[model samples]
Structures are given as C-alpha cells and as structure tokens.
Target: MEHFSQTLARAAERKGGEQNLFNLVSAPLPEQQLLAQTDDRCLAIMTKVVFQSGFSWRVIEQKWQGFEDAFWQFDPHKLVLLDDSHIERLMNDTRIVRNGQKIKTVPLNAQFVLDTANDHGSFARFIAQWPVDDITGLWLHLKQHGARLGGNSASFVLRRMGKDTFVLSRDVTAHLIAQGVIDKPVTSKTALKQVQHAFNTWQQQVALPMTQLSQIIGLSVGSNERQV
Candidate 1:
C-alpha cells in the first residue's frame, strides 16, 4: 500500500498548497461543543438528512422552516408523541415533503433520540463520545437504532453535525479499492473492518483526523467524478 503521506502530498498539490488544502477541511467540533448540542437540533438534522436522501436538497432547504414549525422544532418529546393522525395530516401538509415512509421516520427517529438521551444523559453526549476510529460501527449503530437512518443517511448526519468522521464518498471508495481495503460496497462486517483498518493505518502514518484523511484520499484520486 502507498504511504498516506504520498496521497496527502498529491492532494495538497491539487488543492494549490498545503495551507489551502487545510483551509478546505473543517475541524471536528470540540467535545464540549458537541455535547452542548440540543437534542432538538440533532433530531432536526437527522430528519433533514433522512428527507434529503433521494430528493432535491434545495426543496428541503426551502421548506425547512415549515418543517421546524410543523414538528415543533423537532423536539423529541413532542415528535415522539405524534399520533397516526399527525402522520396523516402531514401527508397532506404543503409545507414539507409528503413521502409517507419518510414522514413516518420522524416519530421513530425521535424515539431514537429520546432513547439515546435516556441511556447517555443526552444524545449529544453519546455522539460526542463515539470513537472516530470505528466510524463504520457508528454508522451501523445509527442504522440499527434510528429509523430510516441507514447507509449514506447516517453518514451524512454525522458529517453535517461536524463529528470527527469520514464518509466513503466515491473517490474515497475508489482509493480504498485501489489499496485493497475494500473491493465492493462496504456492506458486510468484513468489508467495513477492512476499511476501518485502512483508515487506522493511515491515521497512524499521518497523525491527522479521519475526516481530513478521508478528504485527502478523495482529493488524491482527483475530483469531478460523482460520489458513489
């Protein structure tokens, strides 16, 4: 396998220079800041990601205020109390996307937030304390617990929340494949472990966060290609 330094250098060159490349990457939020996040906001973000999965993000962005208002700012206590009548009402509501399956995920995911908060004092604390070294495991946790929070949706939620995490974007996947870390979509436990091991090895070599390493790996392979 190629040393991570070589890939990082290539990325830096493409991004204009090391400093410029660093400017392009976002720092993970501090533990205190992460833990300070309100459960409402976390649920809102999760809801947004779930709805945006296969739809136009622009539409969701425009209607977000309506969503916040309709869902009582995504308060887990309020949302979890929503009955079937509310679901049916929302299906006809013009303010938000009306997909039945996606709309139903709101209450279920709210319970997920509530359950997580109940277990860990707060959902933010649970997310803040999750180790980045096993990000794929985190993804699995979300999938198993949160409604409609599978695969890319779960990953997007963490990324948008500024967690110290890496996404398996198209370029990242391609690089992983080239390095023999994973040969197909990282679905099975074995594939995920291989990807995690590769990232851990690269993290040790470069002493950087997995988020930055993931971006660098994407850049090393070049951009302009759609993310798989």
Candidate 2:
C-alpha cells in the first residue's frame, strides 16, 4: 500500500495546496459536544438520512419541516408509541413523503434510539463512547439495530452528527482499492474490517482523523469537482 504521506501530498498537489485541502476537511466534534446531543435530535438525524436515501436530498431538505411536524419533531418517546393507525395517517399526510416503507422506519428507528438511549443514558453517549478505530463495528451495530441504516447510511448519519468516521463514498472506495485496502466495494464484515485496518494504519502514520484521511485519499484521485 502507498504511504498516507504520498496520498496527502498528491491530494494537496491536486487541490492547489495543503491549506486549501485542509480547508475542505471537517473535524469531528469533541466527545463532550457529541454527548450533549439529545435522543430526539439523534432520532431526527437518523430519520432525515433514512428518508434521504435513494431520494433527492434537496426535496427532503425542502420538506424537512413537514417531516419534523408530522413526526412530532422526531421525539422517540412519542414515535415509539405510534400505532398502525397513526402510520396509516402519515402515509396519506401531505406534509412529508408518502412512501409507506420509508415512513414506517421513523417509528422503528425511534424504538432503536429509545432502546439505545435507555441503555447508554443517551444515544449520543453511546456514539461518543464508541472507539473511533473500530468505527466499522459501530456501523454494524447501527445496521443490525436501526431501520434503513445499512450500507453507507449509518456512516453518513455519523459523519453528519459530528462523529469521527470514514464514509466509503465512490471516490473513497476507489482510492482504497488503488491502495490495495480492498479489491472491491466493502459489503461483508470481512471487507469492512479490512477497510478499517487500512484506515487505522494510515491514521497511525499521520495522526489525522479518519474522516480527513478518507477525504484526502478521495481527493488524491477522482474528478476535480468532487468535494472533500
């Protein structure tokens, strides 16, 4: 595998300079800041990402207030108590998207948030305590427990929530393959572990957050229009 320094240099060279490249990278929030998030907000983030999946994000963003109102601002306590009648009503509600399957994930994922918060004091606490080096494990936990959080959905949610994680976007995956981290897209647990190990190795070399490292690798190769 190529050294991370080489990758960083290549990325800097491609993106003007180190200053410009670093400007595009976002750091994860501190543990205290992450722990400060409420369960309702966490559930809200999950619901937004779940709804955005396979759909236009702009449409979701435009209709987000409707979603907030329809789902009671994504209060897990209330959502978990929603009966089938309420779900049926939401399916016909003009406020949010009418997709029955996606609409149903709100209550299901709400239960997931409530359950996790019940055990960990708060859902954010659970996320804050998870080891960044084993981020794939956290992804697995979300995929196994939360609704519609499979694939990169969990990663996107975590990143958006200011957690330290590497998203396996198309460019990131392509860079990983070029670096011999994995031969194809990460699907199985084994492949994910391999990807984690590669990131961990690169992290050891540079001491940068996995998010920035992943972005650097992505910027090293791919379309210039790609954002970090």
Give the TM-score of each candidate: 0.95, 0.97
The residue ranges of model 2 lying beyond 4 angstroms of the native Cα positions read: 225-228
* Residue 50 lDDT, candidate 1, scale 0-100: 91
lDDT (Cα, tens digit) per residue for candidate 2, span 1-228: 988999999889888889999998889998889999999999999988988999999999999999999999988999998889999999889989899998889889999998998899999999999999999999999999999999999999999889999999999999888878899998799999999999999999999998899888878888874434
Clashing pairs in 2: none
Name model 1 segments beyond 4 Å from true. Answer: 224-228
TM-score of 1: 0.95
Lowest lDDT sum, 10 consecutive residues, model 1, at 219-228
lDDT accuracy of residue 196 in candidate 1: 87
Q: For model 1, what is the error of residue 119's alpha carbon versus the real structure, in angstroms, after optimal superposition?
A: 1.0
Q: Compared to the true structure, candidate 2 yields what TM-score?
A: 0.97
The C-alpha lDDT values of all candidates are 0.88, 0.91
